[model samples]
Target chain A: MSEPSAPVTLAVDCMGGDHGLSTTLPACARFLQRHPDVKLLLVGQPEAVSAGWSRLKEAAAIPAERVRIVPASEVVSMEDPVEIALRKKKDSSMRVAIAQVKEGQAQAAVSAGNTGALMAIARYVLKTVEGIDRPAIATQMPNAKGAATTVLDLGANVDCTPEHLLQFAIMGSALVSVLKDNPRPSVGLLNIGEEAIKGSETIKKAAELLGAAGERGDINFYGNVEGNDIFKGTTDIVVCDGFVGNVALKASEGLASMIASFLKEEFSRGVFSKVAAVLSYPVLSALKKRLDHRRYNGAALLGLRGLVFKSHGSADALAFGYALESAYDAARHQLLARVEQRIQACVMPSPGAVA
Target chain B: MSEPSAPVTLAVDCMGGDHGLSTTLPACARFLQRHPDVKLLLVGQPEAVSAGWSRLKEAAAIPAERVRIVPASEVVSMEDPVEIALRKKKDSSMRVAIAQVKEGQAQAAVSAGNTGALMAIARYVLKTVEGIDRPAIATQMPNAKGAATTVLDLGANVDCTPEHLLQFAIMGSALVSVLKDNPRPSVGLLNIGEEAIKGSETIKKAAELLGAAGERGDINFYGNVEGNDIFKGTTDIVVCDGFVGNVALKASEGLASMIASFLKEEFSRGVFSKVAAVLSYPVLSALKKRLDHRRYNGAALLGLRGLVFKSHGSADALAFGYALESAYDAARHQLLARVEQRIQACVMPSPGAVA
Candidate 1:
């Protein structure tokens, strides 16, 4: 494959996330500054898009021609059900942005919208890759090894077959190869224990399929790993069903926040403690920087025919920009193509019986 | 129920845990000092038990009659399979300790043994409480609200039916009520989202059962709660299958350890930082004390006919003492009786369909 000389085009869902265009537009402006050879098609209601554009123009040096507004009439609120996102709000900004990717006008799509809606719209508009039954949400997390471990099925499909898990292993391996630049990255099947006989019928059967795929050189399956392995950086990629993945991610987020609050509380307790906090300010900041979630904001919705990244709904401009960068990088590296190739080449066990 | 005039008795598995009698004997010595009216039946190989008892006599004021050595011929190693623990090692220390409770020789049993072996032996010997199909491992986690929330089944049964989740909720609620002395502790069904329509079919069905139970005043079910809610203390009890619970527990542990290491590393970077760490020692110590896992060492293997508390295999003397205290507290509050009553009163939905 030859590198494109022209700028990469990306579709931004302007009316997504908690702050809608307010967060997306400024993020696009900041992203444009870092990625000069890039173009953004901001999709949202016309009036809001125009207003958001004016703010971006005032805030940064984003070129007028490099950014364009694709107006839509409807917006998908975070509370909207999947049915409304799928069939009712056909012209939603989230849907229109995904449509641009489906029509090949944009290489990838980025949204900080409601995750359920974004997944539903992306699946409906772009469809899953051939041979894959369901798509998954793959997010990056900071580990103790000072590298982000990629984990999938963050909350796309609820119940997965062993075949689905095997597919996730393949897709996750491809993702780390592009993101971390490590070909044949180790893939771990997240379970309660590391033993061969541990976990459920589905997990046991998934292990067999993953083991076979590993033997075939499709992925470096590292056998069973526990939840702590995610933060311990025991594997480059961890795969599980959406239910378990989502719980782990949200729980870790909660603990991190609680720890930060505890540190602040400890530092501000008394006069002597305040002085000690001032003396330890730099060290505390270093600790904070090490575990910052914003640096790993984007989650790739894998197995789709096109590239789509889900940003946290409450992400600020900087975090949204990180999501944009992640999506752009995925597109530049032909993440979708790699996923297709790996899935096609991989051997899958019987689905219904294993699960 | 009349208060016991005689001293409370506990069966101690001396040959369990990583440190064997080295950990359990000293812990029992420390426990007997604090709880003067308690007795311990130390079960293990004859020579090891006698040697450990001699050391305990030299260490503290544990009376000879208050601590007796009960010999068992076999030992269950950590790597032993469940079948071996169940059928082969019938006279193992783990089994003998659990048997003491079954034979009314002890009020409760405490072991820091192989989790799989402990659970199998406890189930086979004690059997399940009436109306309960499976046993669950319920452990306490310190929350941001300065209270320990009870979460279960940490890793006993994988691939649980909706009915099993309902049982976990009932059991966890009973646990909190006895431990915290709250008559109607609020219970949260752990899921991906708080909305009624979110989570897997099993979770949804469990919610329905819990909601119905709440309506009947069987349990104060608070509906669906996400992972963050566990640390937020959104409810007194959080219920999930073993797979999700184990992952969440282990992931939290990993993150906590990583954050602590990060803090220490930052404070010890250079000479100036080392001085700063000295000044902030008090604050750091407070943070460490608050998040210490040793304070919450015991996990009650609920649903057994008799009370059995499992300590972490790697616990030190102090941590093991905490597990002993927890077991004593559970026995004193009649935790098993409460569980039996709660399960008998609750209604479980059909098993096959939802999960």
Candidate 2:
């Protein structure tokens, strides 16, 4: 294994996110201020980036030389289709930021812009690794065990074959190893039931592939896991196609919102309940920290040739800063290269030789 | 509509559930003692039924004539496939109970045995309603708004066409009208987003059909709804294919379990939380009641010719009672007849016409 080096540089799509440069610039500034070794390349409309830089300079003692702005006239709307990468929005901030990674001008790229556009631009410019058929967005979710579980293909490929699922499992396993620092991370096939005969033909085939892969010691396969098993941390990596993964991710978010709203309503019902809530404030804050997405902001677009990270479009400065840190981690860990090697090792016919 | 007469008679599979006759018979005996107007036909092994009856008599004061034990020598195991309904388990309690519904001896049937067996038996005997391709299971979930939303195809068919989705929506709409007392239930197609073109081709087609159905007043159709919208009561009836619906249902269950476990762990940390918990016990109890599966049992297998309902395999007496009540509602409301009439009124020359 290679020794960890100095902090990596990240190219930020400064004109992205709900608040655009207002959120992205301050987040970059905060991240840079905290990590002295790291540097930033801000890609956006020149005027907006300059205005954001000036505002940050007034508020904080930011080292001016550590940051540089790359002018990009176009800004992809979050609503734009993936086609925006091909034609009209070629020079968009999102595209240019991704290009910085592809061109090796930056170690990694972070974008809080349109997810589809970012993915398309990343794939179009950086391309996929030799063995990966489709790149997947892998996100970390906080489990009840007080640890994070990796859920992949959050929204990459809509339709997936068994082979695609196998690739995702392999990539996710490598990712969990790097992020969670587990030498042999357990991989689980997400399904409706834990039984072998359950789930669709696609899932069944994926299970068989996982079984074969596990036997080869390429990845640690924990067999089938139901939706409920995700929070239990039954496995370090939960693999599924993009459609189910997307729905599951969104459903979890919706549920968290529902529970939060319910809790607030219950606590505000009467004077007694309000008083109880006051006493429970510390515990509630602890619980909120456990569920907070800011701590797990960076979701790597795994299986791609270059390291690319996606932050939530609605992410604030704190979340965006974490996203930058995630990109740095991926770059330092050589995540892309490690994933490629893992995929190559698994795909070969003679697994014994690789072992 | 006809001033619901006497409570409907339900044939209970005495040799069902994890504990078989031990749990089923006692539950039925207690239920009968509570609802004197209702009758039950208990089907199972004659010896087991007799033993269960003797035990029931000792525990509760129940009239013998109100409950009759029908002799069925066989029982369906939880692991058995749907084929058990066809060849092997001909005289099983699960089959006989369903047969009672078909023979008009029982208004509905309740089985806590294998889900596949119940669905198969119901389809084989009760048949599908005219113009209905396949039956769907519709389960009610507690929304954040304090009202219940009905989600269909919880686990019926894995693959569904746009037409099938439309049919499920229509049946689900009719169900909400009868059960929720909504004169014209608002229906929504469950999708990744609320936009008209947000989902796959199948979803887009289903949306068009729903719009047309809404236009003709065959059903009150709201547009697309995302996963988050399910708990928001964005629409009274949320419809999707069995595959997506099943995933969504299980995801919600997982989310609830996750939150409950998290809260439990947080509250158990110290004495202060224990005091706060006791003070807020009433509010928590109310919340639990709202989210309780017992209050939300009886997922109707809609579009079938008869009133067939599926209860949770692990359901207790309270949940079984709710299933029985739902069956009664479906039977008294003539749910099947209403669905048949609606389909006949809305069937078009081209499936695209409704779309």
Candidate 3:
């Protein structure tokens, strides 16, 4: 960790997510109280940011020196086209927050806005790490073992070659190693089956790359694993193309929501059931706490030179705070440097790079 | 449905699945007792079939005229290569069972063996429907509303084109119509997002084909749906390439299993929790029964000329019986004829035939 004279700062896009200011400002206030050593550069419309600050001033002991209002004239709506957001919305809160990272005013940026727009803007300003073909969205999924498994390329680069998957595996491993404090975190190539012969040509070729990398001590490759293995926590890191990963993640979220609703409906059925529900409320709540998606809200946009994290657009105050915490952790642990070193060591140079 | 002069017969691959004869024989015996009008032709080695019949005679009341024994010297192990099973294992139980449909000896074939081998053998013996590009695996997923949503191309054809997906939607609609007596079953094109611009070119093209088909009254096409929509019962049928469908299905299975185990673990944590668990036992058991994967056992291999159902490999007697029951229902409803009619009506002539 680097000991700097200046406080580590994080630029947060306050005009993002579902309930923009209501969620982001309160979450930032809570975060500031929790982390005395860190400061926040709240990037959004000046009036809204000032109004939020005044509302939270006394209750949150608004640290005047620790918080700064970075004015942004425009906002990026969730439905904005990536290209339009990149070119037109130059002073949007998402862009301004990312610019803080680019201009060295803040160590990292966090946004709970349009994923496509955020990625496009971040890539345009910060660019990907040197040897990395594309940036991947890495997120934590709570597994059956009560630990989180890191999965990457959730939906950033949809069409990936075997080389890109291999890069994902290495980057995911590095992120996991730093977060979990484990040097040799195992990485699993997400395939249709555990058998070597299964899956598309791309997945098979990716398997070969990961296997060879494992042998060379670049990554602790755990061979091929299926979709079920992701929840089973079969490995520390699960790697796949953005398309498959996105489908799997969304499907999982869908199923989890359905199951939770079903449980709620069943428990409220009758007098006897209601009584049982009341009696078992503690256990149910405990289980709910364990499986809460909010606990795993922050997803790091890996492979970029400047650190950035994406929060769920629908996240509330607590969930948004978790995203800020995640970005703060990444910036504090030198995640970008670790990812760069690992990518440089493992990933083969692109054909363009060779040229 | 055509009223057959004789009893509807189903060919059973006795040497398939994990337990081979042990699981299939008992399941078949149970099925026979439950549905007296249905007969089974047990295909396997003569000695094993005879031994199983003798063992199940008194208990299951083995009807002598209804059951037949077909001797086959070879067995297709789950790990065997599809090509080898197709060529060398011509006399294998799986092949013989499918051949019964080819030779018009049975209305349908049921196998709990290797999927690749079954698809290969069935396609080779029965051939694809004239306009169909490839066969797909259609399975039922129980939803919140206590109805099954039919998802197709589960793992049958890994790589699929727009035309192939269009064919799957037609066939799936026909299957649901016959099974649930719902003529206009809504089919959703699975994608990363519900937006038109999201997903790959292949999915985009498939969506266009489905939309056109829906306009022509060939099938009911719902717009794009995310993963969660599968369990939400958003549509009657969810169509995608084999790879995405397979991943979604397996991941959901893994999650369901994990959630069950977690519930059990939490409820048994302490004395107070254990008492609460006992009180909530009925509700828990009801939930378990509702979400039971065993209840949704059979997966029909669709788009072939003749009817075939693939049972889960590790299914026990009860689960295997469910598979047999599914095949019997399909035969009774004439699912194959319905599928063929739908495909012929919607699908364009194959290039081979057109030329």
Candidate 4:
């Protein structure tokens, strides 16, 4: 795919996440200053955007020419179910933000809303891209290599067939190639053990399909990796069913956060600790930044006809800005077209169920 | 469940683990010193034990009266398959160690062998306790509340039915009750989300069976809990299928170890950093100790007729000693009989396979 010279536009769900308008408006302001060629369609209730813009106008001097307010009557709460968000809330800011991509008004969409509801609305509005049976969530986890590992099927398709996993590998490879600028990003099958015969039947069959695909040069498949491989940066991309992927990702996040909190507690104890905290401030800050999940905030919803990224619901303005930058980068690099072309290039045979 | 005055005896697989006699012998010598009421049956090649005994004899004065040499002609390699270790290596130290427990020669067994081989051999020799369909691996992970959370079915039954999950809850509760001395330890179903409607069909059905068991006083089911809850100390026991449980636990360990190493790297960069490191040495060591997996080395293989605990294959003498203590505690507290009693009281209505 050829890189386009035209400016990229992104639809921002201003009424999403926990802080909603407060965090999103400031994030939009900061994002606009850094990305001169990027334009934003701020989707939210008219009054909320009007009032919120005034609050952020003094602190952030956002260019007026590149910004436009796209009014939506309803907001998708984080607690809303898929059915309610898809059918009931027709004018939700989250759904309308995605609609901008479907209608070609914007090159991509970014939202920090309910993940289940976001997937449901995005799938309904922008159907699966050709050759994909299901869409998957591909997110980055910071690794020891000072980069990130792209892992897919995070809480999207819980019960994935072997073909679905293969589809994920194809979609994930495309996503990583675009994001990392690697022509042949490696893909790994996430399993219990490195051995081929360790996991369940679904994983075994998935391994065979992946191996065959690798031989045909469909994707650069690195045979098998265990959970530690994700953080060890053993491969650029790790693929698994949504159930295990989601749990493993969350558990890692939990442990990392716990360790960070524990370090904070240890530094705040007594006089010696206070001296240690001051003397070790530089090292501690570096360690925190290296381990922070906030810096890696965006998760792409791949296999859809259009591009949409989900930011963490609890992200602050700085973290939300990272999500916007990720979306802008994806759109500028033609991630959607690259993904479609990559899937089209691969032709894997569908395996009949083995008794 | 009565507290008997009989001396607790443990069969040690001296030839197991990466360090073999070097770690196990010192660990056993230290264990015998601390636990004056415990007896050890060290199983290994006859000559190896005889020669190794002299090496440890200088560094440690292990009481001759309290230790017995049990001869095993073969050693189970860490890479041995279940079939090879179970059938081919019939006289393996791992198998003979468990056999001592079966023959009532030792009250319990502790081995740092190939996990799959250990599970298979132990299951074959001891069999599952009455009323249990499968034996599970229950291990503790350190949490925020300065206690460990016990997680079960780790890499044992990859594909578990709803009934099997209920059985795990019952077995886990009994194990925790015996270990923690809490009559009703809270049990949580490890799922993608805490919502009741969130997981796969199998998990949803398992939730129902666990709820029923909770109502009948068979377990202390705390509804559905997500992955983060395990480390948050939200529940005493977290239960999931072996595939998910194994991956989650390993992922946590990988992240924790990565953080520790990163802290070390940051502290060794320059002279100023070295000064900071000296100033923060106590705080750093405290953080390291809090996150260390070595303190929680033993993993109990539950639901077996006799007691068995698996130590980490890479454990050093200090870590292996913790495992021996865990086994000694489990056997002394009569964990096996309590687990059997709990399963018998469960009486969950096993439904036919749901289409």
Local accuracy of candidate 1 as per-residue lDDT tens digits, A238-348 = 999999999999999888888888889988998988999999999888878877788889899998999999999999988998899899988887888988887777765
lDDT of 4: 0.88
The residue-level lDDT of candidate 2 at B319 comes to: 81
**Which candidate, 1 or 4, would have the higher DockQ against the true structure?**
1
Write model 2 residue lDDT over B50-165, tens digit each, in one string: 97698777678787778888889898887787775557889999889888988989877888776667777788888877667777889998888888889987767765788888
Residue B302 alpha-carbon offset, candidate 2, angstroms: 1.4
TM-score of chain A of 1: 0.95
Residue pairs of candidate 3 with colliding backbone atoms: A254-B228
TM-score of chain B of each: 0.95, 0.93, 0.96, 0.95
Per-residue error at B81 for model 4, in Å? 1.2
Q: DockQ of candidates 1 onward, in order?
A: 0.60, 0.46, 0.59, 0.58
**DockQ for candidate 1:** 0.60
Scanning candidate 1 chain B in windows of ten residues, the lowest lDDT window is B346-355
What ranges in model 4 sit over 4 Å off?
A1-4, A194-197, A350-355, B1-4, B194-197, B350-355
lDDT, residue A237, candidate 2:
90
Alpha-carbon DockQ of candidate 2: 0.46
Error of 4 at A220 (Å): 1.4
TM-score versus the correct structure, for each prediction:
0.96, 0.94, 0.97, 0.96
Clashing pairs in 1: none
Cα displacement (Å) at residue B70, model 2: 2.0
CAPRI rating of model 2: acceptable
TM-score, chain B, model 4, is 0.95
